[model samples]
Target chain A: MKLYELIIIGAGPAGLTAGIYAARKKMDFIIITEDIGGMTKYSWDIENYLGYQFITGPELVEKFREHINEFNVEIREGQKVIEVLKDEENFKISTKTDTYFTKTIIIATGRRPKELNVKGEKEFRNKGITYCATCDAPLFRDKIVGVIGGGNSGLDAVLQLSRIAKKIYLIEIKDHLTGDFFVINKIKKIDKVEIFTNTKVVEIYGDKFVQGIKIIKNNEIIELKVDGLFVEIGSIPNSEIIDFVEKNQYNEIIVDCKNRTSHKGVFAAGDVTNVFAKQIIVACGEGAKAAISSFEYLKYL
Target chain B: MEKKVIVYSTKTCPYCKLAKEFLKNNNIEFIDYDVGEDREKLEEMIKKSGQMGVPTIDIDGEIIVGFDKERLKQVLGI
Candidate 1:
C-alpha cells in the first residue's frame, strides 16, 4: 500500500477546498469521502457564501465540485471513514471497504440530519417523510404536508414546500419561530401555510404510507392529516467514527486556529469542527489553513 | 454468484455511493434501487431493512442496514 502525504476524510466544503489546495501544493493526497457535498447539499438558499449573493446549497456545492475537478486530485467518493488510527509516525484511515496509510489526515466529515424519533417516524420514513426540502419538495406537489421545527431549517422546508404543496402546516415546539425575520416576513405572505407554535409532534401515524401526525398544542392532542412530513430540527456532527479525537460537548471536533485537532498530524474542518461559525466560507478558509498546516507538519518527518 | 445482491441508496448520500462503489470494485453484479427517486423502491427498502438510513444492502434474504464492509465480505465470501 502506497503511503500518501495526506488523506482527507470528507468531500464537503472543507474537504473539497483542502483537496484543491493540496493539489496545488503538489502533495500526494487523495480525498476519501462518502459523498461530495456533505451537509452543504441540504441548504435551500445560501446568501453568505461571499461570491454569489444567493445560490442554493446544492448549486454552490456543484460549483465547488467543478473547481476541485480542475485539480489532479483523486476523490474516492462514497467511502465512509470508519476510523483513523495513529501508529508511531503515520495514520491509518480505514473506511468500510478500504484502508490507507497516510502521513497526515484531514477529517471534514460534516453532519447528518437530526431525526424526529417520534412514534411512526421510522415506519413513515421515505414513505411520506424526508429531511431535505429542496430535494423532495417537488414530490409533494399539490399535496398537503407538514413541516416540523421552527428554526431556519424548518422555515426553509416551508419555503420550498410552499412553492409546490397545496397547503403546509408548520409546527414548532417553541413558543415562537426563531428563524430570521426576513424568512418569517416571507412566510407571512403565504396564506396556505398555517403556523402552529408551542406544538410538539408526539406521534406520526401511518401504516403502508404516512397518513397524518399527532401534535400536542396547549395540552391538546390534535391530528393533522397530511401526505408528507419534513423534519428539519437540526443536525449532529459526524464525529462518532473517530472516537480517539477530542470533541466538545456538542461532539464537534476540537481544532485550533490552524485546524489542528487534539491528535498530532490529524486535523478537522467544516461543520464537524468546533468552529464558531459553520458557514461555507469559514469551512473553506479552515480547510486551506488545515492543508497548509498539514504540509508544514509533514516537514518534520 | 448464487446469492442475489440488491442495494438501496440515494444519490446525494455519500455512504450509499461508497457502498455501491465497493461492490463494483469487487466485480459483484447487483441491482441498485434509488430510494430517493422512486417511492416504491423506498418502501421496499424500508420493509426489507427496517432502516430509514440509506445504503441498505439486501443479499438474497439477508438485510444489512448501512454500509458495513466487514459484514459485506462475510456475506459475499470475499
Candidate 2:
C-alpha cells in the first residue's frame, strides 16, 4: 500500500478545488468519491457562481471538470469512502473497494437529500419517490407529482418538473417559499403549479404504488392523490462515518478558519464542515485553504 | 416481433449510463427511451415498472430496476 501525502474524500466543488491546488503545489494527493460534481450536478441553474452570470449546474460542473483536467490530478471517481481514521503519523482512508494511507486527509463529502420520514415513505422509495430532480424529473412526465420542502431544492424540482409533469404540488412546511427571488418569480407565472405553504406531510399512503400523500395545512389533514413524491427538505452532513473528528449537531465536521479539524493533519472542508454558507464558490475557497494548510503541515514533518 | 431490449433512462443518471453501456458491451441492441427528452416514454416507464428511478430496463416485458448487473446477465443470458 503506497502512502500518499494527502487524501481528499470527495469530488465536489471543495474536493475538486483542493485537488487542483494540491496538484499545482506538487503535493501527492488522491480524491475518492462516489461521483464527481456531487449535489451541484443536481442543480437546475446556477447564477451566483462568480465569473458566470448564469450557468446550469451540470454545465458548471463540466467547467470544473475541464479545469481540473488541465492538471494531472488523481481522482478515484465512483468510489464511496466508508471509513476514515488516524493511523499513527498517517491517516487510513477506507472505501468499499480499498484502503489508502496518507499523511493528511481532507473530508469534502457533501450532503445527501434529507428523506421525508413519514409512513410509507421508504416503501415507496424508488417506487414512486425520488430525491434528485435532475435525475428523476423525466420519469414523472405528464403525471401529478408532489415536491416536499419549500427551499431552493424544492423550487429547483418545481422548475425542472414544470416542463415535464402535467401538474406540480409544491408542499412547503414553512409559511412561505424560502427560495431565491429569481426562481420564485419564474414559477409564479406557471399556472400548472400549486404552492402550499405552512403545510407538513404527515403520512404517505400507497398499496402497490404511491397512491397519494397525506398532509396537514391550517390544522386540516388532507390527502393528495399523486403518482410520485420528491423529498427535498434539505440535507444532513455526510460526516457520520468518522466519529474521531469533532462535529456539530448536524454531523458536520468542525473546522477552523484554516480548515483544520480537531485532530491535526485531518482537515475538513465544503458542506460537510460547520461552514454556515454551503455554496460552491465558498466550498472552493475552503478547499484551497484546507489544501494549503495540509501542505504547510506536511512541510514541517 | 423480435425480443426487444428497452432502457428507460434520464439524461443525468449515472446508473442509466452504466446500464446502457452494460447492454452495449454485451452486443445487445437496445432502444433507449430518454425520459428527459421523451415525455410519453416517461409515462410508459412509470406504468410498467412502478418505479421512478432511472435505468429501468425492460427486456421484452421483464422489468429490472437500476443498474443491477447480475440481473442483467441473467436476463440477457450473457
Q: What is the interface RMSD of candidate 2, in Å?
A: 3.7
Clashing pairs in 2: none
Chain B TM-scores of the candidates:
0.94, 0.93
Cand. 2: chain B TM-score: 0.93
Candidate 1 runs further than 4 Å off: A44-47, A53-59, A185-190, B1-78
DockQ of each: 0.08, 0.39
Please give me the total number of clashing residue pairs in predicted model 2: 0
Ten contiguous residues with the weakest lDDT in model 2 chain A: A132-141
lDDT of 2 at A9: 91
TM-score of each: 0.75, 0.80
Clashing pairs in model 1?
A34-A78, A34-B14, A35-B14, A78-B18
| lDDT for each residue of candidate 1 in A81-181, tens digit (9 for 90 to 100) | 88888877888888888889998999888888999889898777867888866656655667899999889988988987787789999998999999999
Off by over 4 Å in 2: A47-56, A59-72, A138-142, A162-167, A181-193, A218-220, B1-40, B55-78
Model 1 backbone overlap count: 4
